[model samples]
Target: MTGSIDRFDEVVDEAWGRAFRGRPLADRVFYLASELGDFSVLWLIIAAAQGLRSDADADESIRLSLLLLAESILVNQGIKRLVRRPRPAATEPRPHHVRQPGTSSFPSGHASSALAAAGIMSHRHPRAAPLYYGLAAVVATSRIHVKVHHASDVVVGAAIGIGFARLAARVWPPPGER
Candidate 1:
């Protein structure tokens, strides 16, 4: 089982190297996109600022941000310890490939937070759903492009993010007025 998992990780890493890594322009874009989930704080700040415009909007943003922050912690600090999977090591990362998290890689925290934020925010503001989802998708994929996580890592992270967001939304309903 361990051998199979190692093989899978290796194959995915190889594919990522061929397709995404070493590409100058794309590497930079993906590196920046991944920062959207950095500490899950950027999204939180955006939510907090947006919340200032209207109470309902603000409420949803703050709620979603907080939920995402909690989810990020759960994935990064909690689950990652159990998984203990190291990140895909890039032999020679570009200048933009800056993040080097000293944590497990099975569940990309960035991916999780991005998806969670998207799910929660999209639920509150349906019209901006596409944008929220798109950003999450980019952040999730960027984890792989930057060699910080395997494809499966980001995939599972996204699932966790979406699931947690749904759970949070159901348990703690956001303000509704538009």
Candidate 2:
């Protein structure tokens, strides 16, 4: 079973690598998105921007930031340690420079953090849910496009992130919900 899954992952990863690894526009977009997702910088920037709107927005932003921190620690430090999966090797020369994270690639920290942030932000800014999820999708998929994670890794990481956000919402609630 595990072998089959690994084979599937390899096939998909190779396909994605062939499709987008060398394209100029795709390289630029995915690379930028991947960079923005590093350490959840893009999400943090969004949270900071949201804070500038009003006191209520600021409160939500704080909650989102805190959740992101916890999510990062849990995913990057705790879960990645348990999984200990190595990142995908570059089969072909990369067209653009991309950061190679040292952590396990079973569950992408970038994807996990991105989805978690998106889920939380969506609750507070329901109208902007599309934007939140769209950014999350990009950040999550960028891991595969940049050849740092398997497709399964990103998918599972995204699931973990969504689950974490749901659990957080129940425990902490959003600003208005409480």
Candidate 3:
């Protein structure tokens, strides 16, 4: 089973290898995704702006987002330490502006953050669930796109994120709901 999983990881990494090589547009999209998903920056910025303007639901969104992010961070770090899988080896010069993270690559922190934010936001704004999860998917795939993580890593990171989000939500529910 371990060998099969390793082979699958290798195969998927190889399949997406070209995108990190010379394809200009793919490189740009993945780079943007990585940046957008980093520490859940894009979502936090949007939530902050909305909160500053006193928009309805902004406070709850921000609170839930924070909770989800914190929990996901714990999960990501713990899982990474436990798994300790190395990232895929880059064959040649990576595309311009590709950043490599210096952490265990078994569970992608970016993917975990993205999914946690998306899971909480989906409940916060049901109408926007699709967009939230869509961005989460992009973020998860971005980890693989840059060859900083394998497919299984992002998938499990997503699960960890979602699980933590649900648990956090139960502990610190939104106002007027608990």
Model 2: clashing residue pairs?
A: none
Please say which candidate is ahead in lDDT: 1 or 3. Answer: 1
lDDT of the candidates, in the order given = 0.80, 0.89, 0.76
Top candidate when judged by lDDT against the true structure: 2
- The worst-scoring run of ten residues by lDDT in candidate 3 lies at 49-58
Backbone clash count, each prediction separately = 1, 0, 0
Ranking by TM-score: 2, 1, 3
Model 2 lDDT tens row, 23-121: 899889999999999989999898999799999989888888889989989988899999898888877787777888888988988889989998998
lDDT tens digits, residue span 19-132, model 1: 877778877778888776678765787688878988777767767767876886799789999989877767773667466788988888888888888888887778999988
Q: What CA root-mean-square deviation does each model show from the true structure? A: 2.3, 1.1, 2.2
Query: Ten-residue segment with the worst summed lDDT in candidate 2?
Result: 88-97
Best by TM-score: 2
Clashing pairs in 3: none
Q: What is the TM-score of each candidate against the true structure?
A: 0.88, 0.95, 0.87
Better of 2 and 3 by lDDT: 2
